[model samples]
Target: MSINWDDLKVALAIVRHGTLSAAARALGTTQPTVSRRLDALERSLQAKLFDREAGGLRPTALVLALVGGLEQMDAGAFSIQRQVAARDTGLSGEILVTSLDWLGDDVIAPMLARFGAAHPGVQIELINGTRVFNLARGEADLAFRFGSFEQENLIERRVGEVAYALYASTEYLQQHGTPDVGDGFEGHRLVYLDRAAGEVPHEAWLPALARHARIVLRSNGLRAHMAAVRDGVAMAVLPCLLADREPRLRRVALPHPAPVRWVRVGFHSDMRDTPRIRALVDHVVGEFELLGACLNPKQ
Candidate 1:
């Protein structure tokens, strides 16, 4: 007898999440349902897939060996279903896209607004966060990332390059005076991206230029960093896309150009054949190309 796809999905979820409750949460179902599915799957296969222990559900050796292959099959099956549906319905479905907060708000959202007008039936969901969403695990349909992909099973294309520039409120520049590379930023206060100095290329580069400058404010949130800069709390290295439109902040000329970083659009390779996903990916790349001039225009 062929194994039930839904039962296999339930088993895979339990293995990945480590408990029935967690699997239920991920699958948007009740614990009893998950447990029943897992039981049915094991009985049908006549194998013990998991062994309960203090650490959590530890998959048996047989299960561990089978899981990798099963996951690939699951992803392929999902893609096939999506492709069939897209073919039958002419690409009408919801596509979820995740990206960095600033890009999501300033760039992708506006592009989607125009895209929505053209593809009126296709629903788009945008998830904006600094943390990387797991595409392999099917957390997001697509991702706009600053750098390259970690998985070999992902298709990545460079969408654009984002430039960073020194920006400060008019009042702050007036009071503190802009410092050049040789001046060492000794007297001025600086705002920094919090968490780590090495998280982003721009964040790391800024601190290196002003090693002696006082870090008066630090934040991980892009909006908070912009607010700090706008309120004259400190000067910051702001993305040109975000800083160009803010009237409160003025771009300070640096002795040299800040390094440019690449922005890439990525999706799981398994989903590449799906019509809806392909359409969304093409739309995103086209939108970025169209807006490249606007995103980094010089003042």
Candidate 2:
């Protein structure tokens, strides 16, 4: 009577998500694979776990009876995995890291290149997105985010402060004219970041900065926001380090400087002393000298 931990994970994922397709997504497998695995698990246990319903997969009495134990097992497995990872002294093995697209591409990517040169044996998997990965669940080994981490159980450290300012294309400024600060860009157009990109300190600042400006466009990404500004359609509050590099756009002068946001690196509390994670964290913190110039633009 052998049962695979992976099949149990599939069952738990199905129980959590309530659908084969959704569970497959969480498990990073196909829907058919989830169905097959569920069938096999049922055969092994000689009990049906879920019922097919129009709404979704409904757990049967057998699954309901064992679900709690299954969850405990899952947590225990993750705990053991974290414990083993924490004890690793070698700098080898893959570390999964996540961050926003622009930050990962512009700021961290270059730093990673240098790190790669020094530690050729260390493999890095960097994911760029606005979605927050659960470090406590080991979804990502590390994360770089604009605001403090949501989970208090994780370890967080300040990496750098990012400066932002109003920016407009030379052509847009020529056509619409430069915005007067206090006026809230009343007559001008604004391009805003979509709320879907995750809540951050700077998200609120954009609206306050252009209180009277009409948001003509809303983008979920900096790449699109910067493109809209460069296209001369609308101006936006963009990071100085990034916006300043664009030849097509110029920073809008104002009475008070724009808002600033802090970048924080976070990892699971269990990984605090892990050699690889520590090495990476230390390397990133040490780059503050270089990050300062890249994060905060010169006034």
Cα lDDT computed for each candidate against the true fold: 0.80, 0.83
The 10-residue segment with the lowest total lDDT in model 1:
81-90
Q: How far out, in Å, is residue 9 in model 2?
A: 1.8
User: In every candidate, how many clashes are there?
Assistant: 0, 0
TM-score, per-candidate, Cα-based: 0.83, 0.89
Residue-wise C-alpha lDDT for candidate 1, range 28-125, written one tens digit per residue: 89999998998898999999999988876888998888899889988787667544443534577777889887888887788777777788888888
Would you give me the overall lDDT of model 2?
0.83
The best candidate by lDDT is 2
Query: lDDT tens digits, residues 160-273, model 2?
Result: 777888789999999988787578777899887776756555556566657888888888788888999999999888887688889999988866656788879999889998
Say which candidate scores most in TM-score.
2
Regions of candidate 1 where Cα sits further than 4 Å from its true position: 1-3, 43-48, 85-92, 130-139, 196-199, 268-286, 289-294, 297-299
